[model samples]
Target: MHAFTVIRTYLRLGLLNFVQYRADFFLGVVNAAIQFAIQLLAISIVFNQTDSLKGWSRADLIVLVGVHAIVSGILGTVFSPSIGAFLESIRLGTFDFLLTKPVDAQLLASVQSVAPQSLTSLLAGIVIIVYGLQTGSGFPGFGSVVIFVGLLIAGLMMVYSFMMVLASLAFWFVKLDNIMNIFNTMFGNAGTWPITIFPGWLRVTLTFIIPIAFAVTIPAQALIGSLTLANALLTAALAVLFVAASRWFWLFAVKHYTGASA
Candidate 1:
């Protein structure tokens, strides 16, 4: 069967799976609302103490929150579900079944899982972003919006690559689930503050080492008209490098799994 046929079949199955669990779908909305409220409360507290943090006003920070929420939602909806299943398959030895399939192993593993509930968080993020722009009166022009969106797409690609790298680690160290937990911990904390608030070394780590800064901060910076040309170019370069590295790592891991002694 063609790849497109496989994708359509899986997409239908995924949608059916979510429809069967409709209650969780509604709860997703409530959870997203609460999450937004918590973020806004934190922002309010910070603004009460200081008008700005690292040159970002409260509205700017709200945009940051939106960017974080949107990216988090996408991760939860797509990357987390697929990668979690990939890890589980490895542990249970079902990964061999996936490898035997005619379809692309990565594509099969990636599209097999879907969490429809995560759309709630995505919607809430857009709401927060719109509200921020309205209050701040800093609506971006057409070119700026296009740049912001491009940065966002680049950010998502960087994150997907990062997750793939982590998932590939499962082939070597099955016990590295703990490392994934740590990644999640860091990701959760990412939404709390702008990357600029971190120390210089930490900022460098976020930007280059992990690429989380690209996922959350750069898009927010674009929205606020603060993204620098150099930084944007650097983000694009990092995204390309990550994609190449992740593909290499996935292929290497597959070779190792096939009993080729690395």
Candidate 2:
């Protein structure tokens, strides 16, 4: 089958599987609500003690929080779960079936799992973003809007590539599961504050090494009309680089997998 056909089939099976557990849907809604409330309360507490945070006013920070929530929702919904399943497939040898298929391996891994529960987070994030836009001025005109969307797309791609690289490591180290827990912790914190709040060293790490800033902070900056031309260009360039690097790494990992299994 073609890649598109496989993707459609995978998505259908994922949806059906999620539908089998109906109660979990409501549970997911509750989880998203609690998460949103906690994030908003944290923002409120921070703003109460100070008028601004790291050059961001109350409204600006709220918008940042909203953007963070949206991004968090997206990551939890698709990138997180899909990659987790991919790693598991590798460990269990199910990945061999994927390698033998006609479609792209990464594409197959990515579209294989779609948790229905993540929809709750996605909806919550959209609501928060919309609320932030309504309250904050300077919503950005046409050019800025285009740039914001581009940055968001690039940001998502960068994050997925990074996660794929980590998942590919499972081919060599099955016990790497615990390490991904560390990634989850880092991901949770990345959306809580602007990268500017980090120390110089940490900021550099976030920007160039892990590139968390590209995933969350840079996109938030774009929304607030603060992203510089340099940052914008850098994000685009990094997105391209990460994609190529991830493909190369996955191919290398695939060779390792084949050799190990053989």
Candidate 3:
């Protein structure tokens, strides 16, 4: 209950901030629309060359793109913004204030900044997902829907863990903003497509090294009723492992930052 209240407070503050910049909100909406349009255009172009890419039908690919949009929206609205602020605070020596607070520093840093505007992408993603469902295989079974939601949550946790691990590097490399950029570049360029289409080695790289498959592709598979139980369990396990590891790394980085440990 206490944690919920704290999160609600942060969200309210973000809402207030968002209300103060209405124009930026509209601009963000426009930007999200344009981006989604481009993605659809690209998909059209690809389908023009072939009926289906690999084993993914057009509808399946659309769902994949929708999942990608939602993930990107969440990142932009919450994780990315807060991590950027956290990095800047570290550089400006302001992060010490967060450490002194009664709340968890990681929680505080993660939720301090929220881009409400980026939710446009989230809404667009939902619309796209619904369209895909209508045109593709119709609505999935209730069991499948449950599994899809669970996998989506697990995928989100994995992505958050990855971002947190990267952001924690700020303690050691204060000017490592570009590290996040590399992730953005990879996600923007390759995350929208199904990983199965990639070559064998590149598939392995995206799956393990960057883990985009777990973040976007696996969840899409869940929705399409193609996710194997073994792979779903593996993804869940990986999410748990990544979260634990990232938390440990964050503590270690904080200790190093505060000169408490070598």
Candidate 4:
């Protein structure tokens, strides 16, 4: 309940900030629309050459695109902004204020900033997902839907954990802003496509090294009814493992930042 109140307060403040800078809202929408157009155009070009790419039809690919868009939206709206601010605060020597606060510093750092404008991508993703459902093999079964939602949540948790771990590195390296770009590049470039398209080694890298498969591919596969039980179990386990590891790492980083002993 306390966490909920704090999150609600942060969201309300974010909304007010958005209201104050309405131009950002328009720009964010325009940017998301342009990105969606580019993605759709790429999918069209790919489908023009062949009926399917690795057994995924045009509609199935669009669903994958939608899932990527939603993941991007969540990153933009929540993780990216918060982590960026946290890093900036560390560099500017303002993070001490947060450490001195009564709340959990990690939680505060992770949720203090919210970019409401990126929600446009989420809406666009939803529209694309719905369109794919209508044009594809119709709605998946209830069980598949349930599995998809569960995996989607797990995927998001994995992403948040990954970002938190990256952000925690700022305690040791304050100039690590470019490290965040690594995730952005991988997610924007490779995350939209099916993992099967890659070679066996690259598939393993994406699935375990960076875990983009859990972040986008696995959930999309669940929705499309092609997700294997083993992959699903792996994703769930990774999600839990990453979250716990991130939390522990955050505490360790904070201790180091404060000059605490082991």
> Whole-model Cα lDDT per candidate?
0.85, 0.79, 0.87, 0.87
- Alpha carbon lDDT at 239, candidate 2: 98
Give candidate 4 misplaced runs (Cα > 4 Å).
259-262
Per-residue CA lDDT of candidate 2, range 1-262, in tens? 6877876786688678778987888999898889778888888898789977788766676667666666666777667778888888877777778777778888878877777677787677667766776777656677876887798889888878888898889888876788888877887787567889889998998777676888778887887788899999999999999999999999898777763266
Pairwise TM-score winner, candidates 1 and 3? 3
How accurate locally is residue 97 in candidate 4, as Cα lDDT from 0 to 100? 85
Provide backbone clash counts, one per model: 0, 0, 0, 0
Highest TM-score model number: 3
lDDT of 1 at 16: 88
lDDT of 3 at 81: 92
Each prediction's TM-score against the native? 0.94, 0.92, 0.95, 0.94
Off by over 4 Å in 2: 259-262
Q: What is the lDDT of residue 224 in candidate 1?
A: 87
Q: State the lDDT of candidate 3 residue by residue for 132-167, as single tens digits.
A: 878898878888878878888888888888888999
Looking at model 3, report the run of 10 residues with the lowest lDDT sum: 253-262
- State the TM-score for model 3: 0.95
Quote the lDDT for 212 in model 2.
80
